[model samples]
Target chain A: MKKIESLSEYRALLGENKKTHNGIDKNCFLLPSGMEKFISAGKVYYRSYDQGILIFIDENSYYNLYYYIEKGSCFPVFSCEKPVLIEELSQNGSRDAYIAANEARLKAAGFGFYRKSFQYEIGIGAEEPQRFCTAEDEQAVKASGFRYDTACYADFRPQIISLWKESLDFGDISGDDLALELSQDEELLTVISGDGAVACTYLYEIVGRDVSEGRHVVTNPSYYRKGLGSFVLGLTLDHLRAEGIKRHYTWIHEQNIPSVRMHERLGFLQNGRSSIQYILK
Target chain B: MEEMMQILKGVRPDVDFENEKLLIDNKVLDSFDIITIVSEFNENFDIEIDVEDLEPYNFNTIEAMWELITKLQEEG
Candidate 1:
């Protein structure tokens, strides 16, 4: 295992791999102020072994109006579980072998057993237009200063792409050469603030079989305590209710109570989270 | 490493400098510290790095960082 002491040193080595080979993503950024607090008071380190990367973020301000940012592919599955470092699993390690290693790490680290958690994936927009919202109301809401800026998919392509890197859990974000996305098939709307607070959403037409899903409703850190989550959800529901789109799905990390509460406040009920598995080695 | 020296000087002039690695070791640069550095690097180098590059490796040490910055410059 290599101990990474400096950002530059870590980068030089990782440049030989995906951590560097992959370009930057905008939505993945943390507010500079929040980062300052973390740096001055917190310690974050990443270890690169022959197997894979292990990131440790310490001194995190947990349960204090939290937000879910970057996560690995298994995040949705792992939920509250951090991978236990055992003898690095071989690239060819069996699934059972990896699971065994995790069990060993948990036992060794004394990491308590984790209870399975559930998250929701609501089905939205499968039905025809029902409730409709006028541009005037949308503008008035923005003019009132509660909503920062209201831009629909048509109005928000560059806007969405501008924050696109936030979508890292789903794909390879490289050479896309664009910020914001305008969808012929999907609709997205969001509001951004000068302080880097973001709570916007994407509305998909259908889900799992024909089920529709609401991609996300995120409230940035700067505006965490400001009820921005409710505001975004209010707008989304208004829009969905108008178009008669219902049964939408969104993911909330099981541990983020505030966000889950916000969603529940907006009438999003819970569904189960399918387990996500990974082999880092 | 020179890129790092120049970056550090531009961001923090209050302190005398030595090994670029000392900045991280001495607690002068942390995560947020790293963000500011990346932001500044973007402005000065005309290269863009966002969330995907937030690894400790990218800006952990001056000499170590040159590899990524140089690569970005080339890609640019």
Candidate 2:
């Protein structure tokens, strides 16, 4: 596995496999638009194999593996901070090949299969201003005494961090670092309680002109079963629809049956997309 | 304890909640399962278990969950 560093090197590698590179499209593999983002990110690792090129983008605790096989075939594995979560599968690779390629190394390093996230992409329509919240959801929010507020980043900073801590189990994520990333996005929706935030979700611009990435739909675990998750998701979807965003895409863990159900209820399709995660102990 | 086990089984009949103690640590039960189980506990016991009480330690075992309910009920 050779480390692909410069743009020239990456391009040369791609040039070696032009036939495979040409087949990728938005509807298929998650091919990188450019190597510039990966190179500049500074933690990216690349290697050339007999039939494909392996690219690993390490985002501190989370790492994304992009295995570009010959003929434009690609597979991606998105990992959580602790490396315990093996997420996302390739559209073209076989399960055996995927496991053989990475499973041994991951297992030797102490990880195990945590969960799987099913990717969803939806086409948004220009609907009238309507509520996505259910009666039960509204009642739960009211009973819990949390307020829905569309506040600026400054106001949302401290509360959002706490919510992340309570919802996500990975301890490697630093609240300060997360705050820095959250500041980059322009849109946010939050459910707040007394002096704190209970639930929140945000949207960030993607590479395409009208596509936005829906991210970090988190709620404090203490507030679970109170409809906070649905409330936040509904508010975010309504806002996105109003913005005329053509498509919305997100990954929901297979284990989160309620979330999957909620998204389906909101009209997002399963799309028959599957990703595999291999955890090591 | 039996009641808690019954509810757990009802939510996830496939899992042997009586024997599986690593429910939370092993990720056997996902977030949604935890949410459902918590809701059931709240409704059946008439106790409000806030998010702060939702740590993995409390839901890892039927015994731990029963203890949590008892504590919350007594506190109320």
Compute each candidate's TM-score over C-alphas. 0.35, 0.55
Give the poorly placed runs of model 1, Cα more than 4 Å off. Answer: A1-117, A121-143, A146-159, A162-184, A190-205, A208-210, A279-281, B1-76
Best by lDDT: 2
List model 2 lDDT by residue over A1-281, tens digit each: 34556756665665565455543211112223334556765656765555555565665555555544543233333333333334445322323353455555445545565656666666665653445655676667667766675555466667677666556644344455466566665545444453365455443444233455566677666666665666777766666676766556677777777778877877777644456565422
- Candidate 1 per-residue C-alpha lDDT over B1-76 given as tens digits, one digit per residue, 9 for 90 to 100: 6777776665544334565555543444533345456656775677776444555555546665677777888988
Residue A181: error of model 2 in Å? 3.5
lDDT of 1 by residue, A36-141 (tens): 4433543544454333344444422211111121222222122222333212111112123434544543344344344323445333454533323346655654
Question: Which ten residues in a row are the worst by lDDT in model 2 chain A?
Answer: A23-32
Q: What is the DockQ of each candidate?
A: 0.03, 0.01
Could you give the CAPRI-style class of model 2? incorrect
Best by DockQ: 1
